[model samples]
Target chain A: MDSLAEELIQIKREGAAAVLATVTGADENGGVEPGQKCLVRDGKIRAGSIRDWALLQAILKEAEARLKEERSKLVPFDIPGTQGKAEVFFEVLPSPPKLIVVGAGHIAVPLVKMAKILDYHVTVLDDRLQFANRERFPDADEILVGDMAETLKGISITPWTYIVLITRGHKYDEPCLREIIHGPAKYIGMIGSRRRIKACFQRFRDEEKIAEEVIQRVHAPIGLDIRTETPEEIALSILAETIKVRRGGAAQSLSGKQ
Target chain B: MDTIYDQVKEFLDKGETVAVATIVSTKGSTPREVGAKMVVTAWGEILGTIGGGCGEADVRREAIEVIRTRKPRTVRVDLLDDISSDSPAVCGGIMNVFIDPWWKEKEG
Candidate 1:
């Protein structure tokens, strides 16, 4: 294999995020010609070609825009004193965001696995040591055993974090939800039946005095309504919903209705 | 078949130029949905399948071309084309494939 292809494979193995720039035209100096590729990571030029300093500078500006947009496309530019259109391919490879599944119940198992398969960094948290073992969640990046709320105390939830509550029961779900609801997680969900959801909302409304709007943020009865019955199927449904919410997609199902 | 990561790593370790074809989007009844990946090496060896059959063949050809030219591209393959006469597969679907080639950089 060529060094370029080899390096790309290495990047994929290490799960590195990078930007690839390809030149499509060049000036009289033969710099920044068509079909040249460059690899950029962490704001630094790693490899590939755009030989001319001016052309590289121009490509960098366009590369930054492609990275911000997280898009891979041919961008056209005109080199100084050059007549031809300099079209270069700018491809951004952003690391997959982390998805923290706060409960390691039956639902959490599939969710963690599915998230990993989808290239998300997955962490499975549970107070039960047996349930939160590596054997069960081989794909998880981390498995934490402790009080859900307390364990998450020091961990700041970012805009990229995905928090799901599939704890053993409502006892664990409510406290965890109460704590994380105000955090910056991009997606939050709790698995429960209709009655359980109603009861949890009542407690949140009456005892905790949590506003209805805040409670509404929780995706109770989590997962799309595919009438999913099995743990695996339910996990898929929840994942679909979480992706929809994260991608700013409408919450309504493809079958229509919320 | 080897896992996506394993196959990709193997190709890279061998120092072969490779093109990664990811099924970024799909419509109708394509065999594989989004996120499915296929890797094609410079020598025409394939490590995975975006769907299989002619659809995969077309992607393989395109990936080889990308590797030769060191260009990253997205190609739309129609699976519903007539297999017998004009086109490749008749799967009755379409897929948008992103073909990205890997490269090395000199660190200063």
Candidate 2:
């Protein structure tokens, strides 16, 4: 790969934020043509072809704003003495994280609210109109009332999409789980009892011929074992597990004594 | 990985110059969000999409110029230009697309 493409890959692998600034509009007098670009990571020019010292410095200063908002923008900059203006497009390279809540029950209500606070693009889905309406999920980015299993098949599942199956029982969860078991989701957690999950896995293995390793991806008996007692606490635990997966954190108490 | 970077890397390896067009900003409403990208080859072939329609077609024309000149440019697509048409690109918003060229490094 070329250096710029290689740098792009490394940034995504590390899950680090970087900015790609491309000069999109420039007067002929400015000399810098549109499309001349640079990549800034950690406040340094990691890879780029823009050689203007002043323009590079301007990009370094503006990159922090793009990263803070986590949004792409067209920013205009004027060199110290240049007469014309140059508009540069800053493309934030971090893919926005998304959450797909499979059931719009009690746990999902708080879960959707909390996920939105964490800046996740949250979607709530269920098979019943009474349960999956806007009144209950005012903060949800999207809500769908349809066949839970079939709706999942149509939705695009990306590596950044986190799926949580908290249906009333395993019968509902099982159908949804089968649709996305081997798909490319960052996290797939289903709520169930330990014994019930074991039986479900056995059936999946014997009858459906799914690989054990693939079945292992599902976080059955989902959530961090924080001794959750209420639906609110359970929702917090589920969100915590997804955070740990995305940030690569060990679920350890941050104290001197264990 | 389904990133556009991987596709760009493949084309660069083949010694082909390509233009990567990205929607940097939008006002009012837009078909695609910011950072949506589409890759245009020298032959005007498109790999991804930035909300296809007359707007995308306009970007394609500029992308060819970007590939030929090896110069980056920003094209402002006015979705309001043709509101009477049934094209889905009529979002009644304006968007700015930055088209940049990509090629293998010159052996230094």
Candidate 3:
């Protein structure tokens, strides 16, 4: 499958919740492009792009304000160099310590089932209605309907939130990460081989100019050092790491008491 | 069950020193499993529920006694006997309640 499709599938399986912030407004200086979108998941930028750097800076500022107030809405912004109607849309996807699994892929299916059993408020996000249906994910708290970026727009990522990105490939992972990295999620993990992660991190650093520190926060090659090879074992490792981060414990130790 | 915040607020407003018994966990077929709560005062006033019936009534009585003595205790009520003799419930569940008392402070 295509990378975007693959990434979408992975996200669905892992239940990574995020927010989609779209730039619906531009100033006279064209601070924002008409259709620019940014995905925010796990307190980080996940995917899509805001054409205008200045506009994104401003939007990030405003988005931070809205986040503090715990409010979500369609915000309009005027272009810098022109006198036109404001046309920007910013949607906040709020996921608590709650987990939002996208895709329901082989990896995500088990993840969602396990998260629910652990008492997390879990949501499943998938563009394909068939994949996101309740029968497929009976334990899910919500089965969202829409595209990865668009569906993610409705979620809010709090400190209590944890996101696992096991998307099929670079295509879905890039945009999802671009959107999510800016929010306040506690943990953001991605499943990939060492080479894939190295390349992805390199792109973020070289092209996106995302600080190395920020990029380092991401747990790529996701999960603990359990040497898991199967989907279920991989899910267990990932969940274990997530639990460790959520409880403010080190990943090396399974028992959080110490 | 109602929200604990609301229940606590209502109990506080009535000028009652109440013993709140919360069922934090349960096993088997217990009536009102985990999170079930009951509030009882030293003067015999009761509010909320912890598997109401003779077992509940007995719990309330014990709670009032706890309040009078200012001590905390965990009481186990077996519903099987109570259901056949005094209470209306026939659930055959046992409830273990941890009774804690709350009171308003007077002026210094």
Which pairs clash in model 2? A34-B72, A35-B72
Candidate 1, A193-234: lDDT as tens digits:
788888988988999888877877778777787777799998
Q: State the lDDT of candidate 2 residue by residue for A40-95, as single tens digits.
A: 98889987778888878989989977876566788888864678678888988865
Q: What C-alpha RMSD separates each model from the true structure?
A: 6.0, 15.1, 19.9
Q: Is candidate 1 or candidate 2 better by lDDT?
A: 2
Cα TM-score of candidate 2: 0.57
After best superposition, candidate 3 residue A227: deviation in angstroms?
2.6
Q: Which candidate number has the best TM-score?
A: 1
Sort the candidates on TM-score, descending order: 1, 2, 3
Instruction: Encode model 3's per-residue lDDT on A1-258: one tens digit a residue.
Output: 122223333444455544445443344455444334565554555555565555556666766655544444555665444564454444443333677665567788888878877777887776777777888888788888677756676797767677777666678777778778767777778777778878988989999999887887777877888778788888888788888776456666221222
TM-score of chain A of each: 0.68, 0.67, 0.59
Model 2 spans with C-alpha error above 4 angstroms: A28-31, A95-258, B106-108
How many angstroms is residue A33 displaced in model 2 relative to the true structure, after the best TM-score fit? 2.7
The DockQ scores of all candidates, in the order shown, are 0.18, 0.25, 0.01
